[model samples]
Target: MTSVLDAKTLRKEAAEARQMADAISNQQDKDFWLGIAEGWLELAQAWRSGGAPRSTKLKEDSAIGSLCLGT
Candidate 1:
C-alpha cells in the first residue's frame, strides 16, 4: 500500500541525495548520487500516483507466470 507518508519520505531521500551530490567534488560520485536522487524522485512520483498495485510483487503462494515480469 503506497501512502502519502511514503512519498514524503522518498522526496526527503531525493533531496538528501541531491545535497550530497552537490557537496561532492568527484564527478563519478556526483553522478552516482544524482542518479540516486533521480531514482527517488521517480519512485515518489509513482507512489503518489499508484505504485503499490502497479508494483510487480507477487502474493504469497502466487507463482511466476511469465518471463516479462513487469508492471
Candidate 2:
C-alpha cells in the first residue's frame, strides 16, 4: 500500500496537480488532461476507493479508445 503523504507533501502534490489542471485548454483537450491523468487518477481513486490506482497506464492505450471510453 502507498504511504499517506504528510500535510505539506499532500499540499505540494495538490498544488502541482492544480497547476497541471489549470493549464488545460478546454474540457475537450484530451492530450492536456491525459498528460496529467496520473495525478487525477490517483486523487480520484483515493476519494472513491481509498487508495491510488495500481497505475495510470491509460486503460485504453489509444486516443480513439480514450474518446470512446472517457469518464
Candidate 3:
C-alpha cells in the first residue's frame, strides 16, 4: 500500500522534472533534469507493482516445479 502511494508520488515528481527540463535553455541542465525524470519514472514503475505476488507466481510457473524452491 505504502509502496503504491510512494510510486505515485515518484511519478508526479518525474513529471515535474520533465516539465522543468523542457523549460530550461541550457542543454546540460535539460539533460540532467530529464535524467532525473527518467530515474524517478523507473523507480515508480518498480514500486507500482509492490503488492503483486511476483515471486510466488514465478515459482508456480516454473517448469522445474518445486525444485526451484529447493523442495
Candidate 4:
C-alpha cells in the first residue's frame, strides 16, 4: 500500500533528498536534486491551498539566494 505524508514529514524528506543530491558528482545527481526541489514545491503549494500561512521571509530569502546562484 502507498503511504501518506504529512506536511512536516514531506518537508523533512524533501530536504534530506536535496542534501543527498548535493553530495553526489554526476548528471544523475543534479537531476535528483531537481526532483527533490520539485517535490518540495508541490508539497508547499498543497500546504498553502490547505490554508497554511505562507512564509514571506522564506520567499524573500530564496529569491536572494537565486540571485546569488545566478540561475
Give TM-scores for every candidate, taking all chains together and pairing residue i with residue i: 0.64, 0.34, 0.60, 0.50
Candidate 4 is scored at a TM of 0.50
The segments of candidate 2 whose C-alpha lies over 4 angstroms from its true place after superposition are 1-4, 28-71
Candidate 4 residue-wise lDDT, 1-71, digit = tens: 12765677667666776787788789776775756555565556667579533433234245322432464
The candidate that achieves the highest lDDT relative to the unseen native structure: 1
Mark the 10 consecutive residues where model 2 has the least summed lDDT: 62-71
Per-residue CA lDDT of candidate 2, range 1-71, in tens?
Answer: 23764444544554565576677767666455454544444545555666644555545764323642583
Candidate 1 C-alpha lDDT tens digits along 1-71: 24455788878977998999999999998987886676667667777888643333333332211211342
lDDT of 3 at 68: 28
Residue pair clashes in candidate 2: none
**Predicted structure 4: lDDT:** 0.58
Best TM-score goes to which candidate?
Answer: 1
What are the lDDT figures for the candidates, one per model?
0.65, 0.51, 0.64, 0.58
- The worst-scoring run of ten residues by lDDT in candidate 1 lies at 59-68
In model 3, the runs with Cα more than 4 Å from the true position are: 1-5, 51-71
